[model samples]
Target: MAANWMRRTFVAAACASAALLTACGSSSVDSAISPDRFVVFGDGLADQGQLGTSFTVNDGSVNNWTSQLAARYDVKLTPASKGGWNYAYGNARISQSPDAAGNASTPTVVKQIDTFLAANKFADNDMVVISAGVSDVIANTMAFINGTITQDQLMANATQAGADLAAQVTRVINAGAKHVVVTGTFDLGRTPWAKQIDKEQLLTQVMLALNNRLKIDINPLGGKQVLYIDAAYQVNLFQGNPGAYGFQNSDTAICTSVDAGAGIGTGNNRVNSALCTPNTLLPNADPIRYVFSDNVYLTPEANRRLGEYARDIIVLQW
Candidate 1:
C-alpha cells in the first residue's frame, strides 16, 4: 500500500509539475538530494578498478558509469580494495562463481554486499548503487551456445539471476539503505560479442526475459526509497539513433587491444577494454564518438551518457 501510494504520488506530482515525462524520468536537472557517499556494487560496467583497471578504455577519462555518477554528486568513487566505497569488480555475477571472464576469484555481487554490510552501516545520506546482470546474461548465453546448457536452462538461469538481483536489492533496502538505485542487463543483441557468436536474437530474447523478471520482481519493492532504471531501454535509445546521442559509430569498438587469455569470457584472443588505452585505439576512429570500447563494454563517452542519465533520473524523481 505504501509503495502504491508513493508511485501514484510520484506520477501525480512529477507529471503535473514537470509537464514532460523525461523530466519526471531522466532529464538533466540539479539534484536536491545530496549524498555523503556512494556505495557501489556491480560488474564490469560499474567497476572502478577493483581488478586494477576499469572494463572500459583507460584514457584517464571518466570511464566507468559509477565514477561518472559520483562526479555528478561531487564525490569521487574508489574501489573497496583501495579503501573506498565502490566494491564492484570485473565480470561479477549476482551470486554465481567463475565470472563472465571465467575468473573464479572475482567477488560476486552477493559477496560484495556482504563485505559492505559487515564492515559498515548505511547512512541516510549515502546512495547505494547496484548495476549488474549483464555478465550473468553473457555467461549464461555463452554456456548455452557451447552446448553446456540447453536453451531452457539458459532462459531459466537468466530469470533466476534477475530474481537473485532483486533479492539482493531487497536485502540492502531492508538492511538500512535509504536510497537504492538498481539497473538490470542491457540489450546484449546489439553488442559486438553477440555478432561474433552469431547469437544476437537468442541473446536478445534471454536479455528481455531476465529484465522482465527483474522488472516484475523489483517493481513491488519500489517507492521513493527504491528506483529501477531501464538500462536496455537506455541502450536501445543510444543505438537505435546514434546521431542523436553524438555517437558516430555505434556498432564498432574504438580500441584494438586484445587479451591473449579468456578475456570477458567470450573466448581467448578477444578485445578487453580494460587494457585499451589511447595508444591502442584503431586508426582514424574517434574514441569519444564510438559507443563501445570493446565487444561487451561501452566507451568512456557512452559511460558518461549513462552515468548522467542515471544521475538525472535520481535527481528528478527522488
Candidate 2:
C-alpha cells in the first residue's frame, strides 16, 4: 500500500516537474561554458582513491565517472587529501554516519561540501558536482533485509535521504556556485546485488522513492545554473543495450575481488569494487566488454561512456 502510494506520488511529481527540470535525452554539444575547476562530492562512483582505490577496476585509467568527465576538460581530478578537488570517498552517504561499508569515519557528502566551504569560496568558473545517494540506498536496503527495519520504514528513510540530498544541493547553489551538476542514485535494481538476492522489483521501488523525490524537490529552482543528470535513465539505456555500447556483458561483474569485511554495505565477504583491479578479473573476462566491475560499480569502459554522456549534457545545457 505504501509502495503504491509513493509510486503514484512520484509519477505525479515527475509529470508536473518535467518541464522545469533538464531533459534526460540526447543534447547537442555546446562549448560556451568553460569551468576552471570541478568541485566534486559524493560516494564510490565519483571517488578517486580517497580510500586508496576507487570503487571500480583501478587500472591507472579514468575508471570512475567523475574522473572520466574531468578528463574531457583536461582537468585532473585527484583526492582532496592529495591536494586536489575531488572530495568523494568510498561508502560515503549524503549526511549519514557509519557508511555503507560500516565505517563511521567516512566523510559524508555534506561534510565534503562543508570542508570545501569552510576555507575556500566558489568562483564563477567553478563547477560543483554532486553525485550521491547510492550508498544510502544500499545501507538502508541491507538493514531491511537484516530485519532491522520494516519495508515502510525503508521507504520513509529513502524519502528522507532524498530530501536531505536536495537540501545539500540547494546549499551549493546558494553558496555562489555558478555551475552545478547534480546526479542522484542510479537504479540499483539492475545491479548484480539485486539479481543475487532476487529483489530487483523491490530495489527498483526503493531507488525510485529516493530519486523521484529528489527530482521533484529540485525542479522548482527553474533549471538555471543547476542541471540534474538522470543517471538511472542513462544506466538503463546502456545496460539494456550493451551491444550498442560495445559491451558484451552487462549483467555480470568483471572483477572478482571479494572483501573480507563489509564491502559495499551488502555484507562481509561480498565482491567489493574498491578491491577490484585488472589483476582480479574473472577468467576470460575483458574489462572493456563488461559494464560492471562488481555488484555495485561500473567498469572502466562504461564509466567513460557515462562521463562523455554527462559532459554532453553539461555542454548542451550550460
Candidate 3:
C-alpha cells in the first residue's frame, strides 16, 4: 500500500511539473500586474505536499501556512519545500549541484531561490519567508542521545544550520526581496516521537538553544529590509494545554490506523513496527496533543497561529 501511494504521488508531481513547463514555454503573457510573489523554503512543517513519491507520510490536503497567508494577503505563493530536508541542502549545498534533473526530487532551498530569481525579479514590496533547521536538530539529537554522535558535533551542526538559514535570508535580500522573514525552530520535543524516545526534555533544550542562536544571528541582520519572526513562541503558547485551547480529543492518537501511523512516523520516529496496534496515547495522556495529524504534522490551529505570525511580520503590525 505504501509503495502504491508513493508511485501515485510521484506520477502526480511529474504531471504537475510538465504542466508548469508547458505554461512557461507558451508565448508572451500578461506580466504587468507584477503581483507580490512569496518564495517559501523549509522542511516538513512548512512543506505543502512538495515531497515526491518516496515520502508518502504527509497530511493530506492541508495547505501550508504559505498558501494560507498568500490568500489572506492576495499575493502569489511559490512553495519549494521538501520533507526531511535540512537547511544545508536548501541553502549552502545546492549551489554545488544546480542541475534540476539530478536534484528535483529533493532540490535545496538555495536552488529554489535561484529559480525564483531567474523567473521573476522581486520588487521592493516582495517578501521571502523561510522556515528550516528542525531536521538538523532532529538528526543531531538522535545521534547524540543514542551516544553515537558527540555533543560538540550536535552544537556545531546546529550553529551551522543557523548560519545557513541566515545566509539564505541574505541571498533573498540580494535578490531584491525588500521584506525577509526568517522563522524559528518549533518544539519538536512535544511531538509523539519525542515522547516515545524519552528524549523530550533534551530535545526541547536543544531546540531552545538553537532558536536562541538563530535569534542572535538574525537580530544583527535586522534593518529596514530584513525581519525575524519568532514562530516558536506562538506554537509553544498554542500547545501549552489542548483543553484550554479548545481541543477535545487531544489525548487520543492523532492517527487511528496503520497508514496514519506510517505518515506520522516519518517525522522523527523511524519505528515501522507496531503497525496493527496504533499508538494513540499522548505524552502521559495529557489532553494537549502538540502534534496534530497522523502524519505527525502541525494541526490547523498551529498553522493558523504561524500564519498570524507571518501576517504580523509582513504587515509590521504585530
Candidate 4:
C-alpha cells in the first residue's frame, strides 16, 4: 500500500531529532488558497454533491442546518454542486481513503489531489477545504494507550500525521489554490470512547499538540489565503456548554446497538465502536443534547451546530 501522507508527513515534520520542529513547505506554484466569488465546474461537478446537503432524502435534508448555514451567507449552490441527492460520503478521511470500517471506496486525499492535478489546476476562486488527521490520530492514540507504543513515540507519529496533512495543503497551494480551509483535528480524548479519565486527558493533550504543531508549520508564511479551523477547541467548548447550543446530551451517544460491538477487532467499525443508528430513544433521552451519534461520529444535529461554530470562526478569520 502507498504510505499514507499522515505517516509520511511525520518523517518530514520531525526532520531534526533534538529540536523537533515542523517542516512545513508550501508548493512552488503561485496559486493562493483564498476565495473569490466565482463558480468552478469540474468533470465530477454533477456527482460531487453539495457541501451543506445531507445524504438522506427522507428527513427533508434540504432544510438541515448545513443548508441553513449556507443560506444565511447567500451561498447559492445548484443541484450539481450540492448534496448527492442520495447519500453523502461521511466515510471520507483527510489523508487516507475511506475509513477502515466504512462502506466507502473514495480515493484518499493524496490520490484525490493527484487526480485533480491530472485534470485541473486550482484557481483563485477554488477554496479547497481539507480535513483529516483525526481518524489516523484516533487509531494511533488508542494503540499507544493500549500499550502498543510509548507517549514520545506517539508524539513523533502524530507529528508526521500533522506534516502529511500540511504537505497536502501545501501541494494545493503550490498548484494555484487561492483559498483553503483546513479543519484541525478534534479532541478525540473527550469523545465518549475515552470513558476513562486520566488516560483521556493525556490523549486530548496529544491532539492539541498535533494541531498546534500544524498551525506552527502549515500556516502560510507571507500569504493570507489559508485559514485554519480550530476544530478541537470549538468541540471542547460545545462539550462544556451543551445547553448553550441547544443540546441536551453533551457527553454521551444517542445512537447505539447491542450487536454493534459483536466480534469487534481493532478497526473503527460499528461493532468495535458499539454504535447503533436507531432513531428510537428512551422517553428521557433527547438526541438534541447528545454530542455523538456513535463512539466517534457526530449526530446530524451536532454536525449542524459544529458547522455553525466553524462558520463563526471562518467569517471572523477568513
Candidate 3 per-residue lDDT, tens place, 48-104, comes to 555331111233322356555555566645434442212222211222232211233
Q: lDDT order of candidates, best first?
A: 1, 2, 3, 4
List model 1 lDDT by residue over 170-225, tens digit each. Answer: 99999999999999889989888888878889989998888888878878775678
User: Which sections of candidate 1 miss by over 4 Å?
Assistant: 1-28
Local distance difference test, per candidate?
0.85, 0.84, 0.51, 0.50
Lowest lDDT sum, 10 consecutive residues, model 4, at 18-27
Native-to-model Cα distance after best TM-score fit, residue 164 in candidate 4, in Å: 1.0
Worst 10 residues of 1 by lDDT: 16-25
Instruction: Write model 4 residue lDDT over 129-190, tens digit each, in one string.
Output: 56666555664665576788888888877776677777877877788877666765678787
lDDT of 2 by residue, 198-253 (tens): 98998899989998888888878746788887778767766887776678888998
Ranking by TM-score: 1, 2, 4, 3
TM-score of candidate 2 to 2 decimals: 0.91
Best by TM-score: 1
Show where candidate 4 strays beyond 4 Å.
Answer: 1-106, 145-147, 196-198, 257-284
TM-score-wise, the better of 1 and 2 is 1
TM for candidate 4 is: 0.68
**lDDT of residue 252 for candidate 1:** 84
Number of the candidate with higher lDDT, 1 or 2: 1
Clash total of candidate 2: 0
